[model samples]
Target: MAGRIAAVSIVEAIAADLRNRIFTGDLVSGQTLTETDVASTYEVARPTAKASIEKLVAEGLLDRGTHKTARVIELGPESVRDIYLARAYLESEVLRRLARDKAVPGDAVLANSEIAALQSGAPLDVVEPDMRFHLSLIDAVGNERISRMYRSLVGEVRMCMVRVQSLHLLDNALIHNEHQRILELIESGQGDAAAQLLDEHLGRARERLVAAMGGTAGPEAALPSTLD
Candidate 1:
């Protein structure tokens, strides 16, 4: 039992390192990963390396097929569009509810502050705070189903964000300002306006990210009209 526990811990540590590397662009999208390569690099057993790769695959950070080597996820046009659409829908409702109730989430405010502080940090460093801010908004509504649905999309969203940052499509100051503005709108009890702004914010990001990925004939091709 103890040996199994220790092995699980080691797998987690190695997986975490690889996950960060992927997020930071140390391992680019579609880069292959093999158990032998990971084992040699980390000086771990092949089983341990395999477990780590599997873990990442399950998290949607890596893609693997039966008898195929794992590779970092590469988001295409359709996937990016679908993800952003889902996020916009889910978060738009959350923003509307919070605005109607005039209930601001302190955690979201704190996460936005953290985002402001990390303006000069590596692109990946801002991803957590960005996610936290959105998640806090969802949690504020106290809807378990909505929370779970949003959580399911987080892994893919982070990957998209990594692409957005790597391509220099995101401006830290702009992000912070947009988030703060949404919070203010909610506090002022402007539910429809807050939701509209949230939709627009997500739509702009989706269009840019999809464009950067070389996807679709145009931004309007894949994105919903509301986002435009």
Candidate 2:
């Protein structure tokens, strides 16, 4: 049992590393990965490398092909649309509930602090605080099931965002402005309006990212055929 658990942890760690590479565009869409290469790169056993690749396949980040090859999964237009729609639905509802219940009374203050942190030249990770802000809103909704789903989906969402950031397509200022608007709406007790704004903000962000990636509107389009 302990051995199995250790193997699982190792697999998960390799999966995370591969996911980061894919997200950062270091591994482009349809790029083939061999177990041998992965084992060498990660300094793990071949079986462990295989397990890691399989895990990414399960996460929709890779595809297993014939000849014992694993290729990065290509996200098409439909996937992009679906992801954005999911974000809009989940985040908007969370904001609405927070406003209606006055659950996030300190939202403005928190958001402003996030903005300040971003402006402090801390790091790209620090600049991407919108996810945390949205998660706080999710917590306010008080739904364990929804929260679980949100947690599961967040990795994919962050992967997509990382690609957008790599392309320099995402505007931090615009994001900060949207957050401020949402917070103001929530603080003013306009739950419905806040929800609507959240939807529009996310929708526009998706559209802009798609446009920046040459109007492909998908992960494949966002990624190059090969990494530089």
Candidate 3:
């Protein structure tokens, strides 16, 4: 039993390493990962390397080709659109509920702190405060299920932020202003208006990114069941 647990831990470590490489663009889209390379690089057995590859595949960080080789999955336009659209749709609800039922003072205090930090010259790449600001809004709804759903999207969301930053396309001031505006609307009990602003904010970001990436998938397809 201890051996099995130890093996799982090793595989998880390998997966974590490869995952970082993928998200950081060290191992880019469609790059193949052979089991031999994994074993030699990580000094693990073949089975361990294979397990690591499978773990990454499950996380959508890699894909298996017809020849059964693991390759990094490309973040296509469709995927990007789906990520942002769903986020906007669901997050608008968080803001909407915040307008109707959520307490304003606590969330406003937290959001204002983030805005102040941005005003004080904090870099946008430092996403901790940014994440906290947005997450606090979602969390204010007091729905564990909705919050849990947003948690699942964090990885992709961060991926987009990092990629945009790398491409020199991220607008720090724009994002800050938009977030400040949304928070203001929410605290003012303008739920519908806040939701509209949130939708436009996410929509424009998605359109800008997908257009830059050459996606023609009509911006977004059907939403996942989580949206419903």
**CA-lDDT, candidates in order:** 0.85, 0.71, 0.72
Best lDDT among the predictions, by candidate number? 1
RMSD of 2: 6.7
Quick one: best TM-score, which candidate? 1
lDDT of model 1 at residue 14?
A: 100
lDDT computed for candidate 3: 0.72
Candidate 3 residue lDDT tens string, 88-147: 878887788888853564754565466555633323334555666777787777789998
User: What is candidate 1's lDDT per residue for 63-111, written digit by digit as tens?
Assistant: 9999999999888878898999988898888888898889999999999
lDDT of 1 at 139: 97
Order the numbered candidates by lDDT, best leading: 1, 3, 2
Over 59-102, each residue of candidate 2 has an lDDT whose tens digit, in order, gives 76788866668988776545666787887788887777777766
Alpha carbon lDDT of residue 49, candidate 1?
Answer: 99
Clashes of 2: 0
